[model samples]
Target: MMRPRRLPPCLAAAILTATAVAVLLLSASSPGGALLASRQSPPPPARPEWGPGRPPSFAYWISGTRNDSRRALRLLRAVYHPRNRYLLHLDAAADAAEREAMAEAVRGEPAWREFRNVDVVGEAYAVDRTGSSALAAALHGAAVLLKVGAHWDWLVTLSAADYPLVTQDDLLYAFSSVPRDLNFIDHTSDLGWKEHERFEKLIVDPSLYMDRNTEPFPGTGTRPMPDAFKIFTGSPWVILSRNFTEHCVYGLDNLPRKLLMYFANTAYSVEAYFQTLICNSSDFRNTTVNGDLRYFVWDDPPGLDPLVLNESHFQNMVNSSTAFARRFEEDAPVLKKIDDELLNGSSVQLVPGIWCSNLSKEQGRMDVESCLKWGDINTVRPGHSGEKLWRYISTISQTRGCS
Candidate 1:
């Protein structure tokens, strides 16, 4: 389930196609060229919550391409915590100017400067998610985070369409009780329809060698499925443990690297790589929880994309124990509701957490602009929803162990 982090396969293509038009207007767009003139902007003012790093952290890999910069920033605010590490990537399809703009926005944020945890990939390559390149992009991000050395316990992969369902405090609190080695991945050995459609086909990703992104091309013949390893498939989204991430990034054993080469020619290998590796490796296969920890609504035929969420899904979204939900429109009203009710976010400020040292009454709600002074980052105070998540994890975690 902890597949590579990249934009959706089809979406990346569409974004790359628009690069030509975007470049034409780059000079005229302030948002696109704003950061080019100034590269060393000061960091956000220091807040009390994270004065000198006293808490466990998360390393988030959030990626998008082209026009997705705005959505990426919004997601950053929603999940931003001084104690966590963030790496943002806009694929090669986007113009360098556009990527610079995104980085500029990050540089302008005082909070990011103070913590020095948020980073953007200055150089990127086209990543076609349908092929194995998506896995490459994800591994690249993990390697970058590992090099950053921020002491993160987990790696969470997310896209622009994804949104957090709980505050960072609630999420950290709920996960604190569970063992850090436990990876939440939903996997089944039964390949079902994908056996022939995905596993049997040999495809080549043009992004691997070409400067532009393109659809994968089918090879002449089909290959027999392998008995050397059992194939498992499930939701591509995953919450992976730090140790497993290291194994994938550094490849302590030959299996992880060997599987990467085998999957390079397989279609939609992102859906297969991690699933097969964990199930096939004795060291990690038993550490899985058999859940991706995400809430998604599938269509009847279950096409390539999940159903786009709207207002009607609001109640269900909040009620779910999952930490995140997906396939939302860029500015869906449901997102506003999630911000208002769950995250306490607004147009100007992000979701407030225990790290926010001060709060004031404004418009009938609490306003937390910044951490300003100081607060304990190590401690977490879970909200009401955290209790439900705790019970669910405690109950299901016992029964599900990579079975």
Candidate 2:
């Protein structure tokens, strides 16, 4: 092989300086990296436009498993917005090819590429929704979102079975007037049957320690209910505030950690982890809104999951006034109905918003283009759905208090 040529002393110095600056910028861009750099460097500049009177952005963690990539993509498109950030995760149950395909799909969208607001979890972990591994996966997602350093006010978690009932514009407009610190979580202090089935019995999730997906098995011993903190349970889906998420992820208090340990051996910890944390904490208890902002219909004697939404549920779903509804079958007709009536677009097309209108006008096209014109992302225009949501929230807030 031929010897490589050496650069001149001046050129080498310039190259080194450029590389150092690039490294600094990369480190400062991430939330976790910025926290480390703060001890040594000046603080990063703030985005004043994202302050008060602006439409707040949401960081969505949309997760799925094997054969759910297409459904996840549909959900992402339904909820997609230039202002919001999205993280799509495929658990270890999905093969590497599936994960790669999901990433490619996200990158294939011109608007997604333009905004650079979507990401895929490259490293997959086994997740059993019936066990604590699901809770771990959710916490991991929240941590990644925080590290990504997005300027978002809330963190919403969704699954492939979920679909948006309202457009992004409608959701943003309805939330604009809401308090930034409030967390929309459905919870009740009464454990009822879950007290014995979920909390008292001990179980071990193989997903936590195994390389392959496995079901949770019961352990020999049982544990008593803790008198130290009260337990609350509710829907696994949640819309959490930034402050509350930070508290769970990085709070100095020991309550979050203690609960994490307690729930590690519990079944379906996702339903109880955040609920117990918020209800037990003095600081965040007052911020609970007692609603998850999601619509779900369970059977008379509810089974493990909610009934899969179909066309028959369309009218009731529309009247629910919730931003999202869950447990939709793949390519269900109800999703198409919601897309046509509420979202103003097809399932494959993004829900049209002010940004789409701006892009259409700027490009001088009669219809919106696939490529977006990023307008004032901080602004929002509410529609009839927004009015309905505002009314629903107002009515609930007046009567519901944190238990």
Best by lDDT: 2
Please report the TM-score between candidate 2 and the true structure. 0.85
| Residue 200 alpha-carbon offset, candidate 2, angstroms | 0.8
Clashes of each: 6, 0
How does model 1 fare in lDDT?
0.72
TM-scores of the candidates are 0.85, 0.85
- Per-residue lDDT of model 1, residues 86-140, tens digit only: 8888787788888778777776655665566777776667788788777777776
Among residues 3 or more apart in sequence or in different chains, the pairs in candidate 1 whose N, CA or C atoms overlap within 3 Å are 43-113, 44-110, 44-111, 48-373, 48-374, 48-375
Segments of candidate 1 deviating more than 4 angstroms: 1-55, 359-371
| lDDT of each candidate versus the true structure | 0.72, 0.76
Instruction: List the pairs of residues colliding in candidate 2.
Output: none
* Candidate 2 accuracy as lDDT: 0.76
Error of 2 at 21 (Å): 23
Model 2 worst lDDT run, 10 consecutive residues: 20-29
